[model samples]
Every structure is written in C-alpha cells, then in structure tokens.
Target: MAEPITLTAPNNTSYSQPTGLFINNEFVAAKSGETIETVNPFDESLIAKVAAAGSEDVDVAVAAARAAFKNPAWRGLSAADRGALLYKLSELCERDKHILATIDAWDNGKPYQVALDEDLAETAAVFKYYGGWADKIYGQIIETSDAKLAYTRHEPIAEQTPLSVLYLGTLIKEAGFPPGVVNIINGYGRTAGAALAEHLGVDKIAFTGSTTTGKAIMRAASVNLKNITLETGGKSPLIVFDDADLDQAVKWSYVGIMGGMGQVCTSTSRIYVQDTIYDKFLDRFKEYTVENTTSGSQFDEKTTHGPQISKTQQEKILGYVESAKSEGGRLLLGGKPGAEKGYFVEPTIFADTKNHMKAVREEIFGPFVVIQSFSSDEDAIEKANDTEYGLGAAVFSRDIVRAHKAAAAIEAGMVWVNSSQDSHFGIPFGGYKQSGIGRELGQYALSAYTQVKAVHAATCSGAHASPYRSGIISRNSSLDRGSILQAGDHVSPSKRPGAKA
Candidate 1:
C-alpha cells in the first residue's frame, strides 16, 4: 500500500485520509477487489479510492461480528470497560478532529469549518454521552411473587452495518475494542446494505437516511423479524407568528433550510408565516437568504454553503425548483444553478406555495425552501400537519404560552419554540409518522442498539411450578376464575375442589 498522504485544508490544517474499508480492527480491501472513487464535491476531484464491498464481503463482516458477539472476550467485558473504551474513542476523535472533519467535508460536501466545529464535535459528544450510559443501563424488577425473581438485560445487536457507519469502525478499533466486535463494510444500498438488512444473523438495524430507503430496510428486516430503528426523510414545518421577533425568525429559518446545504433530514423546508407580516417577512427573508448563503468550495473559509453531495442531488434540487414554478409558486429568489463549476445550487426560495405543491410536501434535500401565508395559528397548524411526514416543527412567537401550545399541537417527533435545527447530544432525536421509527441520541439511542431480554428465576425450592402449568379449580377454591393462584394460596392441581381424583 502507498504511504498515507496528508492533505492541507483552506485554514492550513492537515489531515491523513483513509482509503480502505475497516473490518475486524484492520483496514482491508474488498474480497472482490471492487473500488468506489470518493470525489471532492467542490471540484469533483478524486479524494480517495474506497473499497466497495459486495454481498459476499458483507457476509464476511457479519460473520466476524457474530463470532465476536458470541466470544466472551468482547461480550463478557464489564460495562465499565465498555464505557472506558467508548470514552477512549471520544478522546481519539477529539485528537484527530481536524482530519475527521476534513474527510467528512470532502466526502459529504459540507463546509470544512462547519464539519469540524459542529458535526465532528457533535459526534464526539454523542460517543461521550453514550459512554456515560454504558454502565447505567438498568432494568426494573417486576412485582411478582417473593418466590420468583424477574429482571432484564440489554444486549447489543450483532452485525448490520451501514454505508456511512464504516467511518466509526476505525475509532472503535483505536479505542481498543476487541476485533470483530465492530465491523465496517462499504457498498451501495442495493448490495451491501440489502445484505446486512436481510442477514438473519443481524439482530437489529439502525438506519438514518431517506424514507424510501428506510422503508426498503424495514421490508428486508421483516423477513427475520429483526429489530429496526429508522431515522428517515422529513418535510418539517417552521411557523413564524406576527408576534415573533422577525429578525430572529428570519435568521433561524434561513439556518433551518440552508444549513447543511439542506441535506439534513429535519430541515424545515415548509415555512409558514402569519398573514399580518407575511409579505414583510418574505422580503427580509429573501434578502437575508440571498446575502448570507454563499455557495462554493467546501474548504473555502467564506463559503457558508457548500456544493451538493453529487450531480444527481443537484439535479434533483433543480428539478424540485422547476416543479415548484410549474405549480404556480412564485420564486422570491435564487432558483438557478451556481455560475461556477461543480455540483452547486443557489439557495432557492419560493413564495405563494400551497400545501399540495410537490416542493412544499416532499423532501428536496437541498438548499430550497417553500414559503406560504397562514391566517392564524390554527391555519398554520393545519397546513403544517397536512403532509404525511412529521419529523420536526418549529414555532416562533413572543407569547411563550402560545408558542408552547402551538409546538405541542404540531405532529412531529421534535418541536422547537422560537428556534430551528438546534440539537443536543443528550436530547432524543427522531421523527413521527413516516419520518422515522424509534429515537436516536440520548438514552433512547441505547434502546435502539440493544435488546431487552427478561429472565425469571425461582427463589424457593417448593415454588418451582412453571408459570404456564395447567391447573384445575373449583368455585369455592381461593384460585381466581382464570386459574391463577391467589397470593399465598398455592393449591395443587390434584387437591383442587374440582379435581378428578
């Protein structure tokens, strides 16, 4: 293999890049020797050549994970040890923050600074937060008979790797986790992803991507009844009341749609403003969006918005803009491709959009937003909840009580009052309705990664009767009508009043 090459960022920071799949604590090539070119979105230059895993390779990775899960060397480790390893991984990420951020920026088409300061920072914080929870995963004891004891144990799901999940496998290895405990395989959704989801050995699948893809995974997982946690696409709504601070609402709304190049699943693409200040807000919102959203290279220090992830995504966003215009929506500003090269689209805004418009209801997954006017809070709520998606919603109002009420009424997994896209490591993140299934981050994420198994044990030698044992009873007996033995009244089946003896 060639020596690792260091690339310099716009800020003069250096990063050493990885070009291979990480599996069983080692960087290796795909068994089929297939490769996928990782391109820099800014110039479409080859950043690295990643090993493209196929179904066979996925099987190998899954087998390794299964073996490791069964091996006491990993599964038998104390929770404290597991937590310590995660903490070590967090530290390693912190030390290599610059390199990790550069890699993400190059691959994902996000600004370098934003990747470093926000995405990488949040990732590290997530590891640390989950690390603290490793030893605290406790189960409740049921109030059964004193002679019987029942408790639960949380166990990690085996295998089931994701496309982007390979990025974290190196960190797991660096943290001194046992080999095979966390395996990474990279490939397209049809091959490697499908294989992982359908593999019977996999106990669970935690997926974060488009709703269409999430549905596919769910279907595949159903074959084996595997546990699934999906965080899917969204068409979240942002409501700006007349009582809201216009400046704050405008700024936050801009950040909500334009941030991450509108690639976030929870981007508030559907915006509603109270009719009283609708025109005024749109004017300022358009001006602010045009002035602030600077699209260019990911490494550019002044670039607030980077190029879309790929040519297809850029075309997709542009297509949505065309659809919006075709639907009679008025373009307020920026409805064209970037003047320069690369997959860049200007931050686009549309007004006079209806709830039924495709651009307003669907997830464009780009720097595009649709704005509409609402007569009152009820109207805004109705419009926001009109879509099938219910991932996230935001309410901007000076009246705290009204804002909270509006937020509560919105049909979404998350609600923000006078804010947008502000997420925390400890906060549970997920969606409602078709947006996703189950929650991620915080303690809720632990539930996704683990399975709950209950155990019942008999504490008394004479109380060894099986809970499912059949019995006979009489009307005069202390046993309940359902044949359940009353507390402190265990009756032998043969000694029952209606016994055949």
Candidate 2:
C-alpha cells in the first residue's frame, strides 16, 4: 500500500504545500485509506504518495458542497458577492504565483519557468475575467400581444457537479463557473473520478484529459442521465499555405508541437503543408527540430523539452512511434525513446504521413508532429475536419479572405491565422463536435457556469388576458383553437384562483 508522501522545501524555502485532498474549504484525508503516488518523470521514480479519495470521500465532498450551496453564505449570496470572492481567490493565486507554479512543475513534467509565467498567469486571468462577469448576467423577454405577456427566465440548474483538477494547480480556481453552483473534487479519474461521475447527486460532469478517460467519464455520467462537457484528446491540424512565412510558421508550429511537452488538449499534432511550400516547410521544420533538440530535467534552465508525465505515458508515446513506422509514416527525426533514465521520448517529427495513418488520426500527446501534403483548399479543409475530434485548428496564410474561409471550413472551436496556439484569457476556448461542449474563458464562461432568472412587476390589470377576446370565430380567425382561451372555462372560483373571467 502507498503511504502519504510529505513535501519539504529545499534549503530555506517556506513552501509547505498541501498534500492531502482539498474538499469543501478545507484540505483533509480520504475517508477511505487509499493513496496515489506522484511519479517523477525526470527519473521514473516515485516522488510522493498523496491521499487518494474513493466513493466515501466523494460522498463527503458532495455533501459539503451541497450544504454550502443551500446555505445563505454561498449560493444564496448575491452574484456580486460571489464575484468578489472569486476575485479575491484570483488575487491570492497571483500573490503566491511562484509556489503554485512550482507545484505544477513537480506534478506535471513541464518546465518550471513556463508553468510559473504562462500557466499560472492564464489560470489567474481566467478567474479574474469571469469574476467581472458575475453580476452582469441577465435574461430576455419576448414581445407578445396586448392581452398576453410572455417572458423567459434563465435559471441555474441546482445539482452536484464534479470536476477533475488535473496535474496540481493547473485548473485550480481557473474555472469561471458559479460558486456552489458547481462543485469540484480533485482526484485521479479512476476511483475519485469514476465515483464523482456516477454519483446520483451529480447533474453534469466536465473533463479534460485523454480520449480513453473521456470515454470512461461519459459512460459513468450516463448512469444518472447527467450532462457532460468533455475536452478530450486531439491531434489538431496546422495548415501552412504557400503564402505563409516559412521561418515564422516553422518556429510557431514546433512550439505548438512541444509546448508544455505537447500536453495541451489542443496541441497542433498534425501539420498540413501546401504543395507549393511543402518542401520548404519540411526543410525548415526539420532544421529547427535538429538544432533545438535538448532534454534534461524540467527545472534545468537549458532544457527546452521535458519528460512525459509518467512511465506509462513515455511508453505509450514510444509505442506510437513504432506503430507509425509500421503504418508507413516515414520518421524524419527523433523517433526513438531517449537514453536518459527518465520518461523521455525524443522530440519526434514524422514526414510523408498520410491522413489515413494512425499517427494522423490518433493524438500523440508528446513532442510529436506529423506532416502531410494538400493540393487544394477544399481538400485541405476536408482533411482537417476528417478526425473524430475537433478541438483547435490553425491555418497559416497571408490572404485574409482565404484564411477566414479555411477557418470557417475547419470544424474546430478555435482557429488561428498565421499562428499555432495563441490563446487569450478573454477569448472563449473549447472544442467543437466531439472535442467538448460549451466554452470556457472570457465573459462567455460565466454563461456556462450560471443561468439567468427574470423578475417582472407589471400592473395587476387585465392586460394578460387571452389573446383572442372576440366571442365569435370569423372566417379567417387565427384563434381557431378556442379551447385554449375560453372566457368562462373555470367552473368555480376555487378551481381557478387567478382566472380573469
């Protein structure tokens, strides 16, 4: 059995991080005595064993969240007040940015500096942006006849919502959803994840991870007829047109392929080059890959790429490289596992790949990119949207009209022009089709996290009477269905308390 691992700061660093589960407003141990070990991909060694929550812990977390929601302190509070709290949390996150970034680096094998600057900054921005939208929510009313007034009330659905806070502080306080409206319990997608999804109290579940895990989450969420928003795996496409800047395209494309060690959900794993610039793009891409292939520990200042999150992930990436070769995708550079004693797969680039190959279809969530050729705009769009997943896509072209046309044709939620992965906190981010449902980030994120309720104070006159007041039905009467609004349908006063007739 794995034991809880305690983390101590090196030298005089005062970073006493929380190792146990964070439930409700406090961190506590699991009700069940299970634990999960955090493996260091740098050395393929066990780093720490954290308290693992099972079904019992899930029940406790859900109950606490339920209590918080029902109480006047949380859910009953005004939207402005909730927004204030979220803003405060964002401020706190920003204050302790270094600590959280270090935690993310240790937990998820990304470079420490990148995690500190980019990941943590974006996480804080997401919360702060939604915090501003908390009080700005509103509803609408439709115009009706003089005798009738019809309005719609958008209301928040009250039910248990379990979320996975993957890779330590990556999504902590990042979600812009309503407070107490959605509950998040952090654990791996097996026991804690499965239990939360299958919990009868939960109404919706949102996940961001591998496709295999997404299928599991969907299956579990199905048990209770719960809605799901899954941001699963992606082998996103990056199209480089003949008119694109070769130097810029090659650099940015490689960044997308290996940024965060290429662990991003919408990482550009597939590259499509126009036949005119196909050879040029390949030459520059291969040159950059060869010149910039350096790997060590994530904390190393000189290291450009880091190891996979675990030994299993490393093995899976290596297996794909072998599979790609067998499936007829020619390896241009770095196709084998690294020699370092860690979960390191070399920054791989495969050329001569076809859209039909497994490398093109599957998401190799590592430092891997597959390049293929396209002859026309229609064919490029067809190949781009051919995957089962459509999270994010990018097209590199100087022609604005052609870029926009291609952007509209690609079936992904987010599309980039002349860039690969340029995400902003103010923009809505999520996938179309099987990639995910709804959107996250910006003011739009508040919509997914909340609902609207409308209140009207109209005069208590007979203005809301039946639409058809005439007793006789004319030749061209629109109110042919007289049974819907009869003048004296209520037989007695007791039967119809608010009847006008």
| Alpha-carbon local distance difference test for all models | 0.83, 0.72
Tell me model 1's lDDT, rounded to 2 decimals. Answer: 0.83
List clash counts for every candidate, in order: 0, 1
TM-scores of the candidates are 0.90, 0.85
The parts of candidate 1 lying over 4 Å away from their true place are: 1-15, 158-168, 464-501
Candidate number with greatest lDDT: 1
The digit string of per-residue lDDT tens for model 1 on 1-501 reads 223346665556665544566767877777788877766677877666677888888888888888888889888999999899889999988987877777677777889899889988988888888889989989878756656777888877711112134556666777899999877777888888999899988888889888899999999999889989998989999999999999999999999999998988899999999999999999999889888977787888898998888888889999998899999999988888785678888999999999888898889999899999999889999999999898999999999999989988999999988889998878889999999999988877888888789887666662756554312234455543445656788667786645665
Evaluated at residue 143, the lDDT of candidate 2 is 52
> On residues 287-313, what C-alpha lDDT tens digit does candidate 2 reach at each position?
998787678777777777888877777
Q: lDDT, candidate 1, residue 137? A: 89
User: Which 10 consecutive positions of candidate 2 have the poorest summed lDDT?
Assistant: 158-167
Which residue runs of candidate 2 sit more than 4 Å off their true CA positions?
1-6, 9-14, 145-154, 158-184, 452-459, 467-501
Pairs with backbone N, CA or C atoms under 3 Å apart (clashes), candidate 2: 154-452
